[model samples]
Target chain A: MLKRVHFPASLLPYLLVAPQVFITLVFFIWPASQAVYQSLLVQDAFGLSTEFVWFENFEYLWGNQQYRDTFGRTIFFSVAVAFLSMSFALILAGFADRVIRGSTVYRTLLIWPYAVAPVLAGALWLFMFNPTLGIIPFILDAFGRDWNHYLNGGEAMFLVIIAAAWKQVAYNFLFYLAAMQSIPRSIIEAAAIDGAGPVRRFVTVIFPLISPTTFFLLVVNAVYAFFETFGIIHAVTQGGPANATTTLVYKVYNDGFIGLDLGGSAAQSVILMILVIAMTVVQFRFIEKRVQY
Target chain B: MVEKRPGFTIVAHIVLIFGVALVALPVWITFVGASHDGARMLQAPIPMWPGDQFFENLRQTFFGRGLDGSRTAPVWMMMFNSLVMAMMIAVGKIAISLLSAFAIVYFKFPFRMGFFWLIFITLMLPVEVRILPTFEVVADLGMLNSYWGLTVPLIASATATFMFRQVFLTIPDEMLESARIDGAGPMRFFWDILLPLSRTNIAALFVILFIYGWNQYLWPLLITTDPDMMTIVVSIKQMLEASEQTPQWNIIMMTALLAMVPPIFVVIAMQKLFVKGLTETDK
Candidate 1:
């Protein structure tokens, strides 16, 4: 990865790298290792004594129905968020890519939502869905359907998913638009000459060309739903309505900080670490494959 | 244009307008909520149009204590804390990443790859996963409720370093060779040549990082327990929690608007640089 003509070996390199290396060691590496170590030890009630029991926490998690339910919920949440945001962004990008006029205006309007904090996003959506005074519920009231996320588990999950997906649409839209723009215009022209309609041309020509971007956005959106949506969940649901909205990351916070189950929390952290590493590997592999193309 | 399809063109405009409306809906609601008086905001089917109370709500949210019975700082104080945290993170990350990338690319040294991998590992383990232990570490160091605890742990970024490395690699070798022939030391060469050449990338990265730092929620929520130390982003959650008692939707929405304005302004103002930074760094 280095340059061909590089400077000779010197002590200055160590001096230069010291700040980043030091921060990583202290903040990232040390804490991560501590999580691994703590996962093997369980503290008794009242913080009295600790026993080293390797893999017991993991086994306990595997056997726990609530934890298994959270695992399933997290998968469902991530997939739904990815699918919703990606498809919404794909449609918007498709339209924006079609007409060359006012695209920048549309893009500027669309991309500002990316700057919003996830917590604020939650706040905005939570306000909109406020059962008493919410506009959405007010609209639904006219249709004779009740809307209240406070007591309804499905509605709570749906609210958090919408909030999360809303924040991510800007990012996915940008990538999809870029990908579509990079496709040669000649292909679409040839398709038009073959008497294919816009829908047929898009389904055959444009969709296949941007499949890589779609795949990449899929991974990115999953990771976003996994980790970055923590603020949205915290502000909106707090894993509420009987843990219907609690994902794995939310579970880690709840168990560790609120529930005061240190060993269990550490075990959850380690599991999350493994998930993140796996996702990163997949992302890098896909990126490298795209580079070769 | 590929072909003059009038019907498709009309359909495209309609879809784009609908998309923009959906995207803008939340912000518009927030804005309308912010503009009204408190009583009006609390009413069902809250007014969709902006109210004349905009300046009054802005004054109350910015200067007055946030939410009745809440023990938080004024909105301005939290905004100040957010600014400090964001500036420190953006500048600190760029500084350290530039140095490390320079050292790795230009100088051959012991454990170079070792250090590289160590930094790369930080990317895999996000702060969310290791929240407890990381919080414990910060608590042990007595850095809680401080800006150092808020920003430093989050600044150890591998993506920025890798981006800088890519930028450096693309620079022609002759620039460094000539600098060496001029008897310039490493730091001097870095200051004179590398930094200047990568200025655009640095500015672009700064915009992205600024938004990233400003929008951080969970880390600041955990660390900054002091009222004065709370960031604007974190305070929004506290205000939302407080709303259960008093339900001051107007002031809360005003605060939300203020929280989002800075970064949104940055993105809209520097659209080109932001797009470049985002696409290049992530890919």
Candidate 2:
């Protein structure tokens, strides 16, 4: 990773690297270690005394129906978000890739939402789906359906998923368009000369060529849904409507900061750390494989 | 060009128009909300068209008391806090990452890999996972309710460091050799050659990092309990909570618009750099 010819060993290098190493140690390593330590210790309700309880926190989490439900809910949320946003982006990119004109204009219009923050995204969707005056619910009311996400758990989950996916569509669109644009046009022309229609060509050739991009986007989207959607969930639902919308990350925040359950929160944090490490590993592994292409 | 079917081309344009409409729906709604008075916003089936209250709402939100009966800072102060946080994070991350990447690539130092791995480990431990303990650490250091608490912990970015490392690696070895032959020291060479070479990448990364910093919600939420230190993004949540009582849709929507405009403008204005930085760094 370094150059063949390098500077001689000196204290200057240490000084140069000190700021980054120091910040990482203090902010990242120390807190992570503290979470691991605290996961083994249970505190009383009054926050006065603590007892060492190894694996009890994890065991308790495994047995708790609510925690398990939250686990399932989080996976469902992530998968739905990935599927919805990716499919929509795939369609848009497919069309945008076909156009010989106005592609840049279409791309510019489609990609601005990537700049929006997750919480602001949440706010925007929340306003659009606001029960009394929201435009969407108003339209749904015309169909003789009552719409209230605040009171309904399913609707709350749906709203959060839509907001999360909406913000992510621009990102996925950019990647998909790039991947599509990189495919050699002569291959598609050959497919066309074989009497294959546009749909057939796309299904048989274009889709297979972009499989790597699909895989890469899958992992990235899962990570986005896992960690980055916290703002969307927090702003939109706050894990409300009987905790139906509380994903694993939101649960950690709710239990520790709001519920004051130190051991449980720490345990959740440890679990999340494992999840992140796994995702990062998968991402890097795929990235290395992608270099071959 | 591939054989074009008139029907297929028509279908493509129609689908694209629909997609754009779907994506722009929420922003349009927010804009329409911001452009109306409080009474108009409270009415059922809120107006889809813009109103003439845009300037009035801007005045009330920026200079006037933000939301009725809510004891929060004015919109301008929160925007100022957000700007400060974003600038500090972008500049701090670029500065430290440049220095460390330079050190790692150019110098043969003791524990070099150890330090590199330490920085890499931050990628796996996002602030969300270690919220409670990190909050405690910051509180213990008396950094709560301050700009440092808002920005410093978030500034140590592994992605930026790695990107700069990749940029520095691609520079030919002859440049460094020539600089050395001219009797230029390491820092001088870095300042004159390396920094100049990486200027475009730096600017591109600044756009991405600035948006990231400005868009932060949770870290600032945990640290900045004082209303005066509240960022516009965080204050939107507070106003949402207060809306349960007062329901000031106009002011809240106005605040949301104000919060999002700066970053959206940056992305649209620097579209090429944004796309380049995004595809480069994420891979």
Candidate 3:
């Protein structure tokens, strides 16, 4: 059957892929290579001196206290955001699964945040958190606790985390909701017939069925938190008050483009690539075993 | 004799209603804040009602900025730039992904699996990892501050291609064979039969891509240095980031509202297809 298929053996893959590959190679791959190459050379005010400095840039960033601190903060930010958002998504998805009616309403509302463009999401968060005029501050003041994100690094970090989680939890919920609904109704019915209550049924049957989805979302959410949070981060804090909000990606941007330290930025980018690769590999190696087809 | 659990339903409704309110709060606040006068927006009690400043605020934002420091450019011009860039990316991604997916799924070719894995692995390398590299590339190509620079790199969407391939795989081989026997060329068969059969998936993909395309911020922000070339997201951010000056929340809110309209409509219009796309049922 396979041999009988008329395959355009010579022309097909090349024809199909030429345009995408061309664009990617020129636009994606070329630039990525240049970034790495740029990292290996030292450039001066007169222009790039182009002398290869093999591991100097990476060494400098690794040993630099500021970059190291930002790297630590970036890890903490990504992990904290992923854990908080995914946990909330899990609880909300679980709760919504039980509702026979009004579930659509819950789903739509939950999904609403996902629909808000990232730019708008940042703006909304900023408006709500603005100190003198922000709603969050007003509410906090009403409760008698003074709130400020501008001058306080911890407060700034907390607010950024909340904003990031707010934008993402809805997305995670949608995926979880779909995965939960995919569970066989008969399996749940059979479990119920065996005197399993909601919690018991969830723990034994539903959890197992949704394990794959959870694992997939874990990797997906972690990647997003690591990379995509830059928009809101850039918009809201600009890596803020005392550099508390400066993430690895933000630093890459700063060092390469803003700081004009192209070599330093490229080095940071390489490290980020390594971190993502490592995290993804770990996720697959460890979590893949827990997931069911 | 029935034991009534009326309270459970009431409690559920209450919870759902409150949850919905919380979710909608930011969107609601944005719209309301956009309409209020700028000074009024920053007052003690945040304005909860829509004001009369929408048009004035919008007009000021769009026409207020100039590119060469000589004359001001229309806000619509910036919107146009963003729209064009987004469309290029969307169209390019869809067309390429469709073709690659068809070839991968239907045709047996050497290194086919390898190509599939190569593209799919990119799904792991989140866009940020490639930024420094991508920037250097654009700069080398002299595409910095240009529209093509904004679109091309991003058009390389492995995820979309993967989705299309998966959808195409579900089509029965018998149909394709029959088409071949009837002398419908491969391209003809793909366009006429396969495409029609996959309408649901196509619609779903369009919505997904449109939302993704519209929400793109960082890549565009990095590539385009000229304000005239800026997307609404970058422009709004520039307003917020003005050093030593109080950022105008009202105008920023207004710009954000305008930016959000496209994706929101795309979602509402294709709402059914989106849900279907998310929950793919096995035939």
Count the clashes in each prediction: 0, 0, 2
For model 3, state the Cα shift of residue A62 in Å.
2.8
Q: List the candidate numbers ranked by DockQ, top first.
A: 1, 2, 3
TM-scores of the candidates are 0.99, 0.99, 0.90
Off by over 4 Å in 1: A291-293
lDDT of 3 by residue, B1-283 (tens): 0113467456656766666677678878888887887788767778887889887877776666622222223557767876787677777888888888877777788877777766766655667877767776678889888888888778877777867776776677788788888989778988998789877787776676667776788888888777678777567677676512665677677777877777777766677776665544211
For candidate 1 chain A, which ten residues in a row score worst on lDDT? A284-293
Give the winner by lDDT: 1 or 3.
1
User: For this target, which candidate reaches the highest DockQ against the unseen true structure?
Assistant: 1
Instruction: Give the alpha carbon lDDT tens digit for every residue of A1-293 in model 2.
Output: 89876778988899999999889988899999999999999999999999999999999999999999999999999999999999999999999999888889999999999989999999999999999989999999999989999999999999999999999999999999999898888999999999998889889999999998999999999999998899998988999899989999999999999999999999999999999999999999998888323
**Cα lDDT listed for each candidate:** 0.94, 0.93, 0.74
TM-score of chain A of each: 0.98, 0.98, 0.89
* Candidate with more favorable, higher DockQ: 2 or 3: 2
Runs in model 2 deviating more than 4 A are: A291-293
Scanning candidate 2 chain A in windows of ten residues, the lowest lDDT window is A284-293
lDDT of 1 by residue, B57-112 (tens): 99999999888977788999999999999999999999999999999999888899
